[model samples]
Target: MVDLYTHILPNVEKGPRDVNAFLTMAKSLVDQGVKNVVASPTYNGQDLEKQNIMLYVEAANKHLQHAFIPLTILPGQKVTIHYRLIQAFEQNVHLPINHSTKYMFLQLPNENTDVLNEQILYELQLKGIVPIINEPERHPTFLEDSDLLYEIVKRGAIVQLSSDSIVGKNGRKEKKAALTFIDKGLAHIIASGVCADTYESYTLPKAYDMVSRQFGTQILYKFMENADYIVEGKAIFKEQPERVKKGKFLGIF
Candidate 1:
């Protein structure tokens, strides 16, 4: 499986402290059935940070080869939201998901998404870049009113739910939001946003089990297929997003 969001790179962002730590994390992911991991360290539009992450990816891949590990680490960045996001992409500072340049893992602020966020997503789409919002379930704004998420998805943005969120690692609110996203067909992919520190509780197998139990196997397959689409830089399959009807919040159960 393709675990699209990870901080497995050594000494980059809040990931593993050293190469040894990164290798351990990679081994754990491989053990959890992850074959392709996108090394998405956080990027705030800094050139130095981007360079450092690339270096870490190169070093990590070399070690994987030496260790004969079957895991393949791909280059990516979890870009923080900013008004000049389109400009960063134009300047080639922002690394897209798997270096595809067509799909990017974008982080939205916890606050309510305003016109500016929509504008950035619109501009990114204009340039052939699809912004996949990372873990919207954890954001307060989304938890407050899920219709906002449907709006974003309607405007050509994809929503990526964290694997841990589905399994209740993030808490009750996030879990509810995640399940709601699946029920409403707003979530396109489920990624193991496993960092170096949180592997035991956030395993991909557990996440899949939780999703299958709650949403069924067909929804699980859609998420897995979407991950492959992202890796291939192709458009993901998105069902028409529907808002949660009043008094139907418990329908997922």
Candidate 2:
């Protein structure tokens, strides 16, 4: 399986501190049946972080070769959303997923959807890059305004659900939101947003099981296939998202 979102790059962002820490995390991922991992360190309009992540990927894969683990690390960045996003991409300041320039992993603010600039996303799409919103299920604004995600997806963006959220590792509310995204068909990808310190490495498999049990094996298959497609830099298949009703209970607008 391909893990599209992860912070496993050593000494970069909030990922592992050293090579040893990264190796430990990598072993955990291998144990969880992850054959490919996209080393997506946080990138907020910076080039140095992306360089560091690449350096680490090169080193990590070399070490994994001797470790006999059948895993390959790829380049990616979980870029923070900003109004200058379009300029950053145009200037080649921010890195896209695997440097493919076709898919980007965008990190939205947790507080509200007001910070999201739909035009920037539209501009990226116009340039033939698809912005995959990272962990929208954990954003408070998305919980309060679920239709915001539906509208974004309708406008040619994709939503990536956190594996930890599906397994209730983040919290109950995030779990509910994750399930809601799946039930509504708003989620196109299920990613192991694994951090070496906080998130459990095995949760990705657990999430696949949960999705299979609740949503069916077909949905689970598509979610997993999307990860592979992202790694291959191919077009992803997306189910039509149903519009979420507003004024629902539990602030699920």
Candidate 3:
């Protein structure tokens, strides 16, 4: 399986802290049946590694090869949303998934202004970058007002639901929101969080199974295939996003 959002890079904030952690993460992913990963490290926080992401990917690939781990690492970055995201990409300050210019993993701020969020989402798409917003289910803004999420996705920004959210690791509220997003056609991709570790390795398969059981195999396949497309820098699949009705998920709000 291809796990798009991963932190297996050594020393990157969410990746293994050292050589031992690196091997441990590699084995954990392999054990979880993941054959490929996009080595996405968060860059917003002070300690998160933003530059030299390719170097991290290289070191991780080398480690996997030497250690006989079967997982392959791809270059990626997780950036917090801001007005300058497009400029940053143009400056080559951060990487898109698999080093492609097509897709990026975007993390929404905890506090969101609807106008600003929509504008950035629109502006990113205009720059030919599909901002795949990460884990909207767990974000307070989206949790309180699902329409904001609906409109952002409607404007062509992709949604990446986290596996932890789907499997109830984040909480029941997030899990409910994740499933509802799928049901409402508001979410396009599902992946592990930017931080990769042994504890998270098991959630992907379980999320897949849960989604398949609830929504059938085709939706499952679409999510899986979309991940591959992002890696190849190609267009992603999408269904017309429908507004998640108000009060449908009030408990989460």
Measured by lDDT, the strongest candidate is: 1
In the order shown, the candidates' Cα RMSDs to the true structure are 1.8, 2.3, 2.3
lDDT value for candidate 1?
0.81
Each model's lDDT comes to: 0.81, 0.81, 0.81
Q: Write the per-residue lDDT of candidate 2 for residues 177-236, one digit (tens) a residue.
A: 888888887899988777777545467888999999998999989999988888888888
Candidate 3, 60-91: lDDT as tens digits: 78988999999899988888876676667677
Stretches of candidate 2 off by over 4 Å are: 46-49, 110-116, 199-201, 247-253
lDDT of 1 by residue, 1-253 (tens): 9988887777776688987887887787788788998888776655345556677788889999998888998899888788777777777788887775589888886554588788888888898889999999888877766778888898889999988888887888788878888888889998887876797666577877888888789878888888998988877788889987766653455
TM-score of each: 0.93, 0.91, 0.92
Kindly provide the TM-score of model 1 when superposed on the true structure, using C-alpha atoms. 0.93
TM-score of 3: 0.92
Clashing pairs in 3: none
Clashes of each: 0, 0, 0
Alpha carbon lDDT of residue 186, candidate 1?
Answer: 87
